[model samples]
Target: MNYRKATEKDLTAIVKMMADDVLGKKKEKFQSPLPIEYVKAFQNINEDKNQELIVLENEKLEVIGTLQISYIQYISYLGGMRAQIENVFIRADQRGLGIGKKVFKWAINRAKEKNAHLVQLTSNKERPRSIKFYENLGFKATHEGMKLHF
Candidate 1:
């Protein structure tokens, strides 16, 4: 698998992968031709210097995995930057092939290159498997993550 920063053209494929999962299937809209908002959101993320939306591709250049990393500078980390990983997804058909590990490793390295002191992410409470996956990657479950959805 190969990884690179995502282009506008990769947005649809990325969204499709996001929607392929159990939780996402329920939340993501999959209209006949999809929606333009996905592209618009990609544009906004792309323009943000703090955000890096990336994709993993096969040798044929078919996008198979994607994630977004946002670098944030905050006083809480001693005025250092932290990387927040989000929207992580790999093709369901492509799971267990070590693709997710590769993608994560790349993200961590990228964060280090950006001078981030730490990398963080939040997984939904419903995904025990994913939580374990993250734990195996050496992430601590020290903090209780909470969110209020509008």
Candidate 2:
């Protein structure tokens, strides 16, 4: 297995992984399948220095996991920055193989590389295993995650 930052060419596979994540849990905010155009948007994230999408691939170069991290500059903390993790997913068959953890570790390092003051993520209550996994990786559940659906 290997890991690398995603390129535009990898969008289709990444979108599939994202879909898997949405389907694997109940109470997730995802409401429908992602269109290929949605992945195209992520592909353009490279234009922003603070945005990144990464993928984990098997020996055959097939993407099996993905994660996106965004960094935002903040004035409240004296110009410090925060890194937010979104859309973390590992292929269903790839679970329990440590691929997810490796992806997260890479994300954390990438955040630090960007000089972020903190790295954060939120998981739904229905995903207890995901919450535990984040906690095991030194992420603290310090805030309530609230969302207003349209």
Candidate 3:
């Protein structure tokens, strides 16, 4: 398998992966359907210089996974830059084989390359496995994260 930055042609496959990740026949609270416009917004990541979308592909260049990072410079952290990992998804059958870790490491390295002081992510409470995966990768849950449906 190969991991590389995503391009326009990879959108359809990436969206499918994301949809599966979000609504995979699981009755999780986080399993809400995503609007088509939300998927279209991912195109902005490809166009933005400070943000990026990556796709994981096989030898045949078929997209099977995706990861994205958004950079934020903050004053509260002594003017440090932060990179937030978002929308990370792997093809369902491809889980548990270290591909997620591989992509995560790649994202970390990329953030470090960009001089980011922190790399952050949030896993839904329903995804205990994913939470453990992030913990194994050195992420800690230090603060309560809340969302309001409006």
Candidate 4:
């Protein structure tokens, strides 16, 4: 599998993969031309120095997985840099192939290369299996993650 920065051409496939799951099905609007909002969001992320949108492809060059990493600089932890991983999705057909672990390892190493003090991610509480998978990856539930959706 090849992992690299995503391009505009890969957006459709990326959105499709993200929408395959239950949670994503409710949140993503995956369509043939894709909504302009997604394009705008991609452009914003691409322009940000701290944002990285990545895609994993097979030998055939098919985009099969994707994730976004955001490097946040804050005054906390003595002004440390934190790498936040989000929107991780492996194609449904590609699940159970250890690809998720490999992608995460790559992301973590990338964070280390960027000198991030730590890497973090939050999975929906409804997805117990995903939480367990994260636990296997050495992530701890040290703090409760809360969010207020508008």
Candidate 5:
């Protein structure tokens, strides 16, 4: 597997993978030529030095997974940098292939390369299996995660 920064050309596949799950199906508008909002958001993330939108490709160079890591510099943790992982998704057909673990290992190493103090990610409560996967990856639910949607 190869991991690299996502390009505009990979947007459709990325969105498609994101929408493959039940939670994503409720939120993502995965259509051909996707909503302009996705394009605009991609532009913003692409332009930001601290934001990394990544795509995982197989040996044949087919995109099969996607995730975004945002490096945030904060005054806490002794003025450290934190890597926040988000929007992780693997193509439906690609599940159970251990691809998720490989991608996460890559992401963690990347965080280390960037001098981040820690790497963190949040999965929806609706996905128990995902939470367990993270736990298996050595992530601890050290704190309760709360969200307020507008």
Candidate 6:
């Protein structure tokens, strides 16, 4: 898999893959042609120094996976920086091809580059497979995750 920082041109493929999955199907909106708000969001992320939107391409140059890594500083962590991994998605056909491992390894390496004190992510409790996958990657679920959705 070829990994690269995403460009605005990648939004369509990113949104498509994001919505192609079960959970995303309910929450993500892909443009029948592309949306203005999505474009704005892409630009915002691109401009943010603390965020990176990554895309993974196959040999054929198709976008097969994507994720966002955000580096933030928290006083609770001794004012050290932490990296949060989010929106990880691999094309349905690309699952179990060792691509996920590569993607996550890439993210972790990136966190290290940023000198982050911690790297963390949250998987929906409904996805047992993802939990097991993360566990296999050496991530421990030591704390409960909570969220307040609007």
Residue clash pairs of candidate 2? none
- How does candidate 4 score on lDDT? 0.95
lDDT of 1 by residue, 68-97 (tens): 999998888579999999999998889999
**TM per model?**
0.95, 0.84, 0.85, 0.97, 0.97, 0.94
Mind giving the per-residue lDDT tens digits that candidate 3 earns over 38-97?
A: 456766776788888889897877787898899988897789999999889898888878
Model 2 backbone overlap count: 0
Over 114-136, each residue of candidate 6 has an lDDT whose tens digit, in order, gives 99988999999889999999999
* Model 1 TM: 0.95
Candidate 6 — which residues are off by over 4 angstroms?
none
Worst 10 residues of 1 by lDDT: 30-39
The numbered model that scores best in lDDT is 4
Q: Report the CA-based lDDT of candidate 1 relative to the real structure.
A: 0.90
How accurate locally, in lDDT, is each candidate? 0.90, 0.80, 0.81, 0.95, 0.94, 0.92
| lDDT tens digits, residue span 31-77, model 5 | 98799999999999999999999999998999999999999999998
Residue 138, candidate 4: Cα error in Å is 0.3
Error of 3 at 19 (Å): 1.5
Pairs that clash in candidate 1:
none
Off by over 4 Å in 1: none
Candidate number with the higher TM-score (4 or 6):
4
Q: What is the clash tally of candidate 1?
A: 0
